[model samples]
Target chain A: MNVPRHWREQIRRYRLVGSKCTDCGRLSFPNRAVCPKCNSRNNENYQYAGRGKIISFTNINSPPKEHKYNLPYAVALIELMEGPVITAQITDARAEELEIGMEVEMVTRKIMEYNDDGIICYGYKFRPIVEYAHP
Target chain B: MKPNKSVGIIGYGAYVPKYRIQNTEIARVWGNDPNLVPIREKSVPGADEDSVTIAIEIARNAIIRAGINPSDLRAVWVGSESKPYAVKPTSTIVAEAIAATPFVNAADWEFACKAGSETIQACIAFVGSGMAKYALGIGVDTAQGAPSDALEYTAAAGGAGYIIGSAKESLAIIEASISYVTDTPDFWRRQHEHYPKHGNRFTGEPSYFKHVLSSSKALMEELGTKPEDYNYAIFHQPNRKFPLEVAKILGFPKEKILDGLVSPYIGNTYAGSALLGLAAVLDKAKEGDKIFCTSYGSGAGSDSFSLEVTDKLAERKGKAPSVKSYIERREEIDYAKYARYRKKIRA
Candidate 1:
């Protein structure tokens, strides 16, 4: 029940709070302490809306032991509207329905739980926006 | 009783997950039963969604519509039966999520389905006493029913949140309210039990209808208003038939109740039943519209309110996503996915 890591990472996971270098206008996800591009220590918390399109995606017909119950799920690399790319499991849509450029949005979901009686870790996941943005 | 201070709802929000499990899918898994009727569909929480995350979404949406600084809220209360942790406080997490922490009184309240209303009543007192400028009351649930019980057919996930403040800042002023309770045991879940148990057919007349009718009548009689005076009516909808039937008995037309009877589409979200219904009606109500609401909880009691919409509602009803939007964006899941998502099966 003591997942201190879960507690520390909750803010970034819950609200998609990333990092942006005030010096170089560089953006980093997972709330980095320093700028990855300019190596600058000046940074601020950047809240990403988590709206963007998929760069690539795949169907996971086979999964790891803990995720076998959720078969035939979709995983994708999404470029956020705030200039960050992250890997996430796509939900609320079938694999065939996902296209390379299809739009997506973030939602908070259980990423992992230590055990039935233990701590549940929640994180952000992207789901496809069925209504195309262009329409 | 009339509150000494006039407290009103400055903002309200409702959240329903995108996933849905049709009653047909449920019937396919467990053949049609005698009791399963009128509940056509139900909202299902995503694999990661729980009462806490649901509460966060509800709080954020409410904050957007409230147009008040979250730090200004002095109290945050959550009412639910399906709390994620037995020992932890859901209100603290919700308050933190909305950036309203450290300076707030946070706690969880429980009264089966009427838990949310109980918190709302408390917030009414909190603001009415001038202890705080505003307080947040939330009713949410991600309740699970036993695999093959009657509760499984309609137990659903959803919630709504409200921000209570002075009448000058409110979208609707709570003119009057009344709560009627009795020592009736129609439904309950024992400590450590995974699901709730109920008295078959006994939950209807003795519990739901009795408390709902009594509270509604007491509030209306005290105010000297009739059902026709209200432009809209919302009831705790455990099922479609119950709300429609109860409204008719109270002399409310179908047209006045249909807009808020969301159980047919999303099932009984327990504590959220009446709060979500209130949010839905608020999205459509105009200035000067009078709204009647009543919430019922098994074991057993009801909370009724007579609210009048104001110009503030017309100005901010569209600030956040509407309840209709969440209902419109529905994705159907098969029983297998439903079982996995709902944790009826472990990976």
Candidate 2:
């Protein structure tokens, strides 16, 4: 019923990760219960994109409660350089600077915070690649 | 098996709620006159209804119109922006209500007004791929916006359903289809939200007229047909005037588009406007006639198709609920009734 924390982190970092059914070559975004392309329940294989281009983006002036703190945030549907388009929040640029087809690299960052009885809950978000520091 | 075969519309039916609120009534509620709203009357849903319920009613009517048992359908798809629940699939509830279970495919789809038509197209693709036999596409909504807002007059209630597959046993043949999509936020609503946010003038000329007209032109050109070739050109109606104005701009004569403006009377059903207009057209269309349809959705996209009326049209003519009858069966409610019907004012 919920996406796993690291899987959520993989997306927040713009790792361009998805599950590729070893049984069938069907690509899944945010993983899957089974391969819709092949109906295979064994989804053990996971892959990452690492790079993509923004297909479309929207600057949300008024967002939902889950995203209330990130007002004037940018949500983009990015077409991975490898395959498939996925939706995620854009990072590393002001709302005014984002445009369609802009090349971006995924970086891991804090996404959202939940106030559960005064305990802060943090989640992952994807930041744009402006300067990639080699490890 | 691949259902790459042609799936025509075997049966069709529509339902618009019986409460009609005049523009003057809305204007009066807002302390203005009728002309202030400029639009005409709009149909309103009762307290017991939601998009899922209305869709079920239409699907039931469609099954009846097609002269088939509801249990025979293999797949069901409900297309609407105003779904009853965001998480659970509304299609499952509708499928269970209409008894279209033990089937492979059933889901709720979103794309604004074009959702239903797109569902039809997807059903056709699925059936053609041999994945399904009969698929039902239902579009229904009680689209709500803030009272006294401009959208209040046009966001209305109604639904349309189509059972697709087979020419020998179908009501009409889907001759051709083309879709055009653009990334633009002309109109949208969020989860658990009652009101829709729109870009006003951006919804019309730039998004709707632009995408619909472009797709219609592309379809016409591909088919080597002109605007005059079609008996009617139905668009995802936001109001009474947009259809006429767009039709005129595209050289489709005035008469060809008037009957398609059912939204001015029934309000905008989100996904049901175009197909419902086609239902109105079917009530009068002759055998061997062609109907050009261009359906639009906000966030915006358009699906244009050509349908050829079949000989079987006469069999279901008077049996199913007619557009005129639904219009006549309505009861005029006062502003208070309207508020109650839309759940805008608390009891």
Candidate 3:
């Protein structure tokens, strides 16, 4: 929650910017320096397309101390369009509305308030994608 | 102000918070008739959302609609009255979030409700002059209104963003633009003030009307086009009535104004009002359609632009969610939940 820690995780926090294995073409969130898929060190920076589908989900009715204020929130494992499955908070919908295979898109939002002085942290959250009929 | 080289909106996007606070709920808490409320419902940002977050979301969609890499964006400008931090620039956060940092010029702008349109002017200037190939301009706000105040009924959250580039690559071409300004002090929020204060009826005639009508008329005269020539006319909507009255005074038909009348659903998004209205109109406009947009800000000033839709508009319109969809996606919340979401109440 401090400035240094916040700065360090900014890539993953913003835009789901991560790493991709150049050799095997596997994507990794949190941006690993090494690719696990091909066991190759040949990795390149990649930005996820932010489109994905819910693979699984859970409701956090009882949250930890820091996240207690946001109780009853939903978290889900999302399979990105480019093929990386990552965990993220599901927003703009209730627990009952969530379903497996629901289309979702990444949205930037406040993650938490780090301290009383109001140093807030921001990150990505997923929301259901509303499809519009083309006119 | 017409740019030296032609510049237009290559792409555009909009974001409205899913959480809505209905007028009836606000009226219930204030012991007033819901029928008297200026807006039917207003958007409320979630605990995990703010002006910066909203800006980033819409900017990403704009980037997508532009069909360009985020790094191609050379400038990022955000206009808002409800920026997350007063001293810090919201533009940098937005640029970084959208992966446009390190190479882009970033800044924040404030001109009350007209701030967003001001960004549009700057972006057009930046791109038209070849200072940058692609510049992003956003008008977004998580507007604040004092508890139980009249402003609370109409002051709401939402915004829209546009990527400005050459007319050849544009979805809508900017034909002409003009601005009218004066030292009108109709609305203001002093330093450290939680909510803005207005000169009541003073915000009308001398402020919104004077600036919008003059600017719109000037742009039309310069373009040699009349209200009848435009397929759609969009004016900044502080309330449903203001834009309607302004449109009528300018000789634009009600049908021309209704397509862009979004404040009734999302409240006045301050800097985002006019831009969001433009987005709604663009969502439904076809190629060859002419549109007139004018924005009013308290200080006060108005920026008017004459735009012509391009064939590219039809192809790129589906690159991102339509403004109509964002409006349709909603979940109504009660006053207490609205208070909690907006952080008016501490947990």
Residues B1-347, model 2: lDDT tens digits = 12346668888878787778888888887887666674678888754456765776688668877887767787899888876566778787677556566554788888988888888888777666766677788777777767878888888888798888776777788877889998998888877667888897888888988998998989888888987778877877888778888888889897887766687677777788888888888777767878888888988899988888989888776666677667665667788877875667653
Cα deviation at B281, candidate 3, in Å, is: 0.6
Candidate 1 wrongly placed segments (more than 4 Å)? A61-72, A129-135, B33-36
Maximum-lDDT candidate = 3
Worst lDDT run of 10 residues, candidate 2 chain B, spans: B1-10
Chain A only, candidate 1, TM-score? 0.86
lDDT of 2 by residue, A1-135 (tens): 133653344332323346778787777777787898889987763555456888888888877775554445788888777686778776535468887778885533234434422212222234454331111
Backbone clash pairs for candidate 1 read: A110-B48
CAPRI-style quality class for the chain A–B interface of candidate 3: medium
Worst 10 residues of 3 chain B by lDDT: B338-347
Q: Per-residue CA lDDT of candidate 1, range A1-135, in tens?
A: 558877888778877888889999988887778788988999999888768889999999877755554456799999998778988888767699899989998766666666667876767778775341100
Ranking by TM-score: 3, 1, 2
Best by DockQ: 3
Residue runs of model 2 more than 4 Å from their true location after superposition: A1-135, B1-4
- For each candidate in turn, the TM-score is 0.92, 0.70, 0.96
Per-residue alpha-carbon lDDT of candidate 3 for residues A1-135, written as tens digits (9 for 90 to 100): 478888888777877888988898888987887888778898888988788999999999877666655656899999999888999998888779999999998887787876556667888889888677544
Candidate 3 deviant stretches above 4 angstroms = none
The fraction of reference interface contacts (C-alpha pairs within 8 A across chains A and B) present in each candidate is 0.18, 0.00, 0.58
